[model samples]
Structure formats: C-alpha cells, structure tokens
Target: MPSFHNGAVEIAYLDEGEGDPIVLVHGFASSKNVNWVYPAWVSELKKDGRRVIALDNRGHGDSVKLYDASQYDIAMMANDVLALLDHLDLERADVMGYSLGSRMTAVLALSQPRRLRSAILGGIGIGMIEGGGPGENVAAALEAPSLEAVTDPVGRTFRAFADQTRSDRRALAACLRGSRRLMTADEAAGIAVPVLIAVGTADEIAGSAQALGKIIPGSEVLDIPHRDHMRAVGDKVYKAGVLDFLSRQD
Candidate 1:
C-alpha cells in the first residue's frame, strides 16, 4: 500500500523479496493483482532470489488517477516509473510489461535506456497503428449509451480485451494524440538489449506471433497454442519462455 512521489504523480507499488530488482507493469485499468499477482512470475522470480516491484499505474488500482489525459501518455507513464526507481536509488532493473504496460516499457527503453537492464513487451505491434481504435463495427457499438461506460457484461468483456491489447480509455485517448507513441519495427530494432514479444495462437489481435521475433535479433517469439491474450499468462509455455529469458541474465 506504500506510495512513491514520482514527480507530479504518486505511484503505488509492491516491493517484495530480495536481489536483482525487476519491475512488473500491468495493462491499463488492470491492477497489479489482476495482470501479475495470479501469474507465477512473482513467485518464480522471488524463488530465484530476486526482488519484485509490481506497480499500479496512475488512474488504476490503488494509485491515484490523473484526470488530465495528457498525464496518461507513455512518456509520462515511463517517467512515473523512472521516478520510482530514483526514489528507491536503484540504477537499473529489468522491466516486464503487458499490453498498455508494454507501450510504457518501450518508452522506458527509448527514454531511459540506461535504467533498464532488459525488457519484455507483450500483446502489441506496429500493425495496430493503421486506424487502430476498435474496428468500424465496434465503434458504433461503443457509441451506444449502454456501451460507453464499463461495469456491464459487454463493457466488462471489452475491458478485458482492452487490457490485453492496450485499449485503456485514457491511454487510448492519449494514443490518438500520439501520447502513447508506439515504436515502429525499425525503431525497435535500435534497442540492443535482449527483448521478447509473445502472443497466443488464438489471439485475434495479430494473425501471427513469429513475425515479431524475426524482426528483433536474438529475440524469441513464442506462441501459446490454446490461449488468447487474456489466457496467455496462465500457459506454462508463456511462463517458462519469459522466465528462461530472464534467468539467462544470471
């Protein structure tokens, strides 16, 4: 429940275990518990004698929401995390982010490359940029008064989809204005550190998972056979792949 004063925004995070510090970032709207606490990453990393820092981004979870859309951009979001690292006086740490969190992770790599020992970005792609709000059909449904707000079955379903695909309202709103400037395949190529991007075979988000891995040298592409974006975290192959990537650093 503790918080850190990271610039104008205060970030709430879980600081547990001990050893090489690693930060876990969840998708927008989803709390640390939803995206990661259920996953084996925390226990798996901690079991290997490492510290885990799971963050609740502004406007979500236990953290205070930034009413201003501008504050929700990836650059600002990354800074909130950097400030947390500064407050803790740590120089560098490995970062792992899913969906919206992955966009922030990319920004961290670009803006604060020195602070990141490595990174893991999941559930995203350059293909998303081509008129990537919801599809034309869903936009109409989203416009309906009943669908505008979350808390309903359709809204709940969409919320999960959003989390898995970086569709948080404020975050996406910011993205429309280039607030969450996602990197192109070429830009991502500049990042020299070990990076991993994985997707589930059944995920409608992208037709293929292998396409991304081929773009980043030394990067591995993994597909969870029966899982979608929402269920990928629970797959043994997903966990094993990510854990193996991180464990290699030691």
Candidate 2:
C-alpha cells in the first residue's frame, strides 16, 4: 500500500518494476487493478526492464474521495499526478491514460509537456475537445439505482460498469464530473512529447482516437481492430504499439 500526500489527496499508487518510469492512469469507475493490474501488462513491462507506476486517482480505489465536484476536475487530477511525481522525486516519466485518465493526461500535456518523456492517450474522442462534459445528468445517472431504471443503458457495458462501481457510487459520480474537462485539437497539437493516441476500431467510446492523434507533433494513432474500449487495453497488439511509442526517444 504505497501512498503519496499530493497536497490535495493521498494518491495510492502501485510502484513496481525497474527502469525508466511509466505511469498508468485509469479511467472512470476503474482502479489500477481493473485497468492495468489484471492485464499482466505491468509484469510484461517489468520484464522489459521498465518501471511501472499505476495510480489510484482521488475518489477511486483506496484513495480519498472528495464530496466536492470541483475537486474532481481534470486540473486537480493532473496536479495530483504531478504531486506524486514530486513526492517520488522523479522529474520526468512516460504517461499513459485511458478514458477519464486520458483527459487528465491531455491537460497535463497542455500545462507541463516538458515533464513527460512520452504520452499515450487511449479511448479519446472528439466529443470531449471543448474542455467540458455533461455534468449533473451524468452525476444523477451514477447515483440512480440500477434495479429501478437506466435512462439509456449501454447494454452489458453499462451493467458491467455498474457492478464494478457497485460499492462506491460517490467516487464514481466524482469521476463522472471529470468528463467536463476536454481538450481541443489545437490544444493537443501543442504537446511536443512523443505521443500515441490508441483505440479499438470497435470502441464506440473513443469516437475519434485517430483524429486526436493526428494533431499532435510526432504522434501516431494505432487502431486495434475488432475490439471495444473495455477489451482494447488487454490486447497484445495494443501493448506492443504502446511499447513502441514510448521506447522511441528523440
């Protein structure tokens, strides 16, 4: 149970492996274990001699949850990551994020691109380019009882997610507020670090991962065919693509 008091929250992170640091940021209603832990990706990277650090963002996993919606903003989340880096005394590291985590990494690139060795944005879409997302509506959906009704259930994806967050609705709702922070194309283009925008061809959530990648300097988009957002992260092709992206320096 490793933790860092990131000024605003105690970010619980899994620090494993050995070599250049690579931070893993998980998406909404997901923990480090759910997103990256079970995938065997961490061990694969460690075997490759790369350091892996997967964090539990505030309001998710073992970290503290703030009742305030403002705390769940992307800026705060990004700051918490920066604080974790500061706590570890690591000046620079590679970053990879998915869904809500991807948005957080986007804000980090915009605010402090120099601190990143490289970046991987997964399951990103054009719908979130405006730096804001649906608010109370998403929050309410998070709070609603699944046994009663679902305004627009996305089939098993919705049910699976509900089960995943069944124990902690508030944290999930807080993460839902984070959807409000989106980055425009021009904003993404400003990032000079090596980047990879990756998504599955069947990922309905990532409406435009390719479009998101094209704008960044020296960034590449890798499409994993026949996979959806939930399944993309575990594919060998996806892992290889991400590894190639991060390993290429200068």
Cα-based lDDT for every prediction: 0.68, 0.77
- Give model 1's clash tally: 1
lDDT of 1 at 160: 48
TM-score of each candidate structure, all chains considered together: 0.81, 0.91
State which candidate has the highest TM-score. 2
Residues 18-50, model 2: lDDT tens digits: 899988898777888888889887888888789
Instruction: Give Cα distance to truth, residue 38, candidate 1, Å.
Output: 2.4
- Per-residue lDDT of 228 in model 1: 70
- Scanning candidate 2 in windows of ten residues, the lowest lDDT window is 126-135
RMSD of each: 4.2, 2.2
Candidate 1 C-alpha error for residue 114, in Å = 2.1
| Model 1 lDDT-worst window of ten | 128-137
Off by over 4 Å in 2: 130-138, 165-167
